[model samples]
Target: MCGIGGIISFTTDLGERHRTADEFAAALHDRGPESGGRWLGRHALLVFTRLAVIDPVGGGQPMVGRSGAAGGGRPEPAVLAYTGEIFNFTDLRDELTRRGHRFDTASDTEVVLRAYEEWGPACAERLRGMFAFAVWDAAAEQLHLIRDRFGIYPLHYTLTDEGFAFASEPKALFRAGQAQPVVDRDGLRELLGYTPTPGRTVFRDVREVIPGEIVTFGRNGLVRRRYWDLPAREHTDGLSETIATVREIVQDSVRRQVVSDVPLGVMLSGGLDSGIVSALADREVGAAAGGDRLRTFSMEYVYNLANFRSDEMHASPDSPHVATMVEHLGADHSELLVTTDDLMDPAEQLAVVDGMDRPIVGLETHVAFRRLASRMQPTATVALCGDGADELFGGYIWFQDPWYVQAATFPWIGPFHGMEMHSGLVDRQLYQELDVPGYIDQRYQEALAETPLTGEETAEDRRMREITYLNLTRYLRTVLDRRDRMGQAGPLEGRVPFVDHVLVEYVYNVPWAMKNLDGREKGLLRAAMGDLLPDSIVRRGKSPFPTAQDPAYRQSLRSRLQTISEDKSSGVAELLDVKRVEAVLSAPSQGLGAGVNRLSIEAALQLHYWTTECGVEFKL
Candidate 1:
């Protein structure tokens, strides 16, 4: 893994423009600590900070091709700056070699450059990995940028009058002077009410290159086009065959992502996704690298053992489950215990939103993982996360609907299905003042447009599609974004093996019946687990990363709300009435569903925090 940044221009001075690229790359230095370089030309420049993952000694970027420009029978010399790992590079390289493409380095980055030279933009469709790359065409004066199909790797860009500026993170663009501090109101609504959908960021002028999409720039101006998307296909395979295929694809993905020079590990949540990854990685890598087994990391709160409980609706606590899986797998494991006080720190939410560039749900667990990354970075350069499994395998309890079973695709829509619960929790004027309906619905409509279903698509498939679509479009993006920021913030590279293209494609076509065979969510996945994970862990219901259940966390949030109320002209004050907030705080029964005691008070606090601290000025 590495960091990529660049500047493309038609008339901008090459020497001066190169400085912008340098600054952008510098801002991402933590992402690539091993080596760095810059590629410069009259009309274009590219820069890279490489963390020596694959071909440690040989791979470096901005990697310029040895050949000269096309025409005059000369091969086109393309310079590439990339940040990611191509898990299937061995196969890709063999195909490229058979086609007479010479190689000087055993690096997937080079394979991609050669592949692009051979297939142009079409190359992305054949690639199966998490990547964000930018290429400069010296002769054509054109620049090309592409992102992975699931948007696992982030690439933010800003278009200026002179040319285009891009980077692996928004902060890099800001540092390059291509970005100004403009806030998008709709983006704020999404971040506060729902997960910020893929392809949208907090920054107004900056845009994310969509998953499976390519954006190109030249004298004609910028053109954006989709290179890949989820193919709507009818499932015909039996449950057994589908499960077998899923096992093969997932295992291959895990094995391929273990191709780093630096030590690697997995975030073993003791759930099926993480457990499967840990088991496969320990077996595959231990065999390949002699006795070096996969390392594992997990987090639990202090006093968690006492607070742990399980019901039919929610699974048993993750700590014990994760412990059993780690012991069964016999992998080197480390667990960090955070206190409710640690999670309830006054400034923790602010730190998260500041680093993430937006507010997100599940804030406490996100911080815990980040703390784990910082601690484990001494022994691991990359950490694998099992993020996409839930979306692909119908793992969300909300997705078990019989209606979704018969529907064509994603049935996870209608997230705001029951706002009526808020009617008596808070005053009517407060509900109207909050205007959660107008704000949330607008963002929801925008998200639906991003992954619209056709008439030919079934309701079951549509629901499944919506779930996985939102996973890719929102949930997964948020997870990957948090992983990148939190991990790379400490110079650690976080890899998501489940987001591999091959695995994603296999799951995309598997029918909902296969995903949840025998009335079990992710039943096929469990069947495929075989000897990798214990049946107890495999059959366990989903438990999100552990967070504090203590009342201290709630009080911490209420304090922040109090602070927000004190700041008379704060952006958070505009939407939330002070009287309503006081009333809600006094009642102590709002912000949650009926029979649900504690609320997502921290989430509400972060919403207020984003407005005041992040300057998310509201237009509503």
Candidate 2:
């Protein structure tokens, strides 16, 4: 909802800390354009740019409150800075008010400050929305930072001698100089591993607060604690109950997220996730005054011939699936199409690299959305995304492995060994020096080992926890980061209804048999929406976010790779085997082994870009 940044120097004065906080806030100015404020206290100072979501008249942040134990009034107040929307504030506010909590504003930010005042750290459990917040407890001289249970919002922090500095984005923290500019090589390896975990950012020193986790930095030193976890449970609800509950939760989630001062829209892929979100937005906005009918956008390509050149051409047939629901919703719709040339812009690629703070996969569409969002920014400040459905519903192709999908393990947390050929593209010694393979293997093992697998259960059951965990901890976070960076970069707010912590918990606890009853993934969600969406739209199979198929995009990548190889001054030149790289891209991609071309070339290209642009030094 807004951008928050601050610095806490254990041994510094107000003047120095205020200066640093200003820079941090300035770095995030685009995230919150309505208003900006700074709160200077005894030990720490906070600054926030306000988007004016809840209380346009009074809801400016860096909200301060006196700390108290439960109902008792305190001598001093805690200074709080937050960046997110708390959807359940009306309910929380009423309850707190009954409990004798008074408020000065009709804003969720104030409600959150009061909630923390009334319940201490336990306040997070009572919250039900997407948020990442930092509370500077001046009395306790501790900085308490918390991220939502699903990590739908971001909070990156770095520990410094001055104290702990945190912000809504990595760029802000980078500006604060609390963290080094060096890219996190290990994280790059993990991304190459195809699992960019949410908790780790590209900067080694800048770490994101993991979902459901809290960190308190005080004189006792920094302590990280888990405030929540999705406990595995057996689903006892009837089929109908499970279906109805999912529908209700999703509907409620979408309705709550639509509450922004500015107009909002939906990203409709005509897929079930976006379909459901669009339907909910369509219904909600109608009942609310001064709101616009939901605007939806889907990407397409000229001629449909763009497929042959798609940088990530999948032999398994797929297409942009959007028309069904867009027509049904009867909402304002725009299908933005681009040529291979549109996506091949080196400048756009560089912008994406800079936007994400690292070279990334799926940049083509992310960049596309950035452009699309820019066009929509004149009409809307926020857009709802259907990002978490696939991970939560066991919708990946690999999940088709009955054992893997159901085996009480994480479904999307696997070693996509397709990067081996790309590893060959690099000098064997330099590749080993990067220790890319070992680094990637470590992340996967850590992910799998974190899940408790019982041999007795079906593969779906065993992998349930792991898959859901990966969705929440890794994939979902990446999507959130992408949506947040892209949307905010265009000065638009991005909301993910599927990442609702309450719904995530509910889905994770649903019995595997119920989740994919009769061998259909996401069967529960489909049944839940029974009549809300047209049967055709609800029944459509899952398709990942749309990507370009333009042959020029592939050619562009090839050209970029060639340029990287020929540019002897490029840092990546030392690590790459020019001959092997040429052979891979020059040949037909069909003969590449399972998961080979997509994974390897992507990694090789990402690595080359990182070394040349991201300033990532290849150790080897």
Candidate 3:
């Protein structure tokens, strides 16, 4: 795991290139703190920061490879600046060696470079891990950027007058002057609306390299080809057979991901998705002779344990379940209890906004993850997370609720909820111009049109398939991005085993009936791994990540929103509706958490800070 940035410009001066490269490296310093280097070509410059996970002594970048003299007219050279892990690099290296390729270092970086040489662009099909990489082929005078099948890792790039610049995060591009901190009307729609367009970012010109995609750029302009996508296939396996297949795929993914040189741990949320991962990891570690006990980490709000209340979103606090699992596995566990003050800290909130490079909702959760990553960094470099399972296996409550399921728009942003939370504080005229509702419906239809189907399913099955596709493609990307930014901010790599393409493809084809076997969310997963976990965990209802229920947290948001409303020169003041802001401030404390008012206040404050601190220019 590392941070990578590069520029492919034929017109920029050498001095300017050096300055940009330096800024890129500095911006990404936290992502790779161990070492850093730069590779300069006549028309390309690559900068890499190293985390040294696979082979501490030998693994480094940007790695360069040259073709053999035999059958090679003027030995071609290719340079690679890569991030994320290739869990199957050992197998690829063996195959490449059999094909007469030699290696100088025991690193996945070398295997990736050789794979590019041996298979060219087709090599992306063979890789089975989370990654985003850039390859500069001097011979072709082209740059190739590739992201993993599920986009567990992030890569952003922007087109420039001379050429283009790419990086693991958008701040690196902005710092290097490759892109500006600007948001247009459409970008605001994307932000204020809960729906996420696949390749679009909050920043104007910066865009993501969509998952399972390879983008190539050169003097002939740019070309994009999708190397993989969720396949539409008929389900032939019976219920029992499907369960076994899911177990096998998930276990193999966990086993492959646990092979890390640096210390590793699991993020145990005490929910079924994370519990299954922890159990499998424990079994894998115990199977190894003389292996130490597996390490697990979890977090909760400081006052949540005593004052927690049941709601539709959170069924129960995670502490008791976490204890049950830790005892069942006899694991070495660590838990952090975060205070309301910690969640409300101005400096901490600013750090998260800066780290994310956008005004993000759920400030508390992001802050909690950042704190958890910092706690784990001293002992582990890699942490397994259960992010994609909910999206893949239908674990969210909205998935099972009839109203949400039958809604015309994206289920998460059904007519009654979610969308209003983001737009409640914005100016009425501006909100009308943004037209978040229209944008949501438009994007929703676009996503539904892209939903793959076999055409032989019942009406219910077809609708379920569309819902699953929306969750995986749109909702899950936001979850994955949050994990990437927070974990990488701690310089920790968070791996999602459930997101393995083989597993996603297989389960995506499973009929909704089989997925909801017992009329429960994630019933398929529970059936597959239930025996491995305590019964309580297997039976626990679906609960989203815990949040602070303390009224003081809401009180803090009200105070901040009040201050912003009073200050006419505030960066986000013009964007907000003063009447709406005053309504929130003057509302009774007891009425704060009712509906989505609390969420709206949080969003407004985050936007204010992001605009002020990042110098974001609004083009509305």
What is the C-alpha local distance difference test score of each model? 0.72, 0.71, 0.86
Q: For model 1, how does the per-residue alpha-carbon lDDT over 1-620 read when each residue is reduced to its tens digit? A: 57888787777777656567768777788778778998778888788898777888778888877564322223658788988888788999999888878888988889988887877778888888889999886656788899988777788888887888888887777777877655655544444455555567766788889888999998899999999877656667787788788888887888888777778888888788888887777777753346665688888777666876664335566777878987786778888888877676656657777667665666787677667777787778888878888877778765775654443323333333343322222234645665756765666566666664555666677667666666666666766777887776456788887787767766777767677778887877888884677778867877666657666676666676677668776665554544546654665564343321233445556656777776555443
Give lDDT tens digits, candidate 2, residues 510-565: 77788786677688888777477888776667666666665556666777777777
Give the runs in model 3 whose Cα sits over 4 Å from its true position.
13-16, 70-74, 286-290, 415-419, 589-596
Pitting candidate 1 against candidate 3, the one with the higher lDDT is: 3
Residue 126 error, candidate 2, Å: 0.8
Estimated TM-score per prediction?
0.88, 0.89, 0.97
- Top candidate by TM-score: 3
Question: RMSD, model 3, all Cα superposed?
Answer: 1.8
The full ranking of all candidates by lDDT, starting with the best, is 3, 1, 2
How displaced is residue 207 in candidate 2, in Å? Answer: 2.0
Best by lDDT: 3
Model 2 weakest 10-residue run by lDDT = 310-319
Prediction-by-prediction clash tally: 21, 22, 0
Clashes of 3: 0
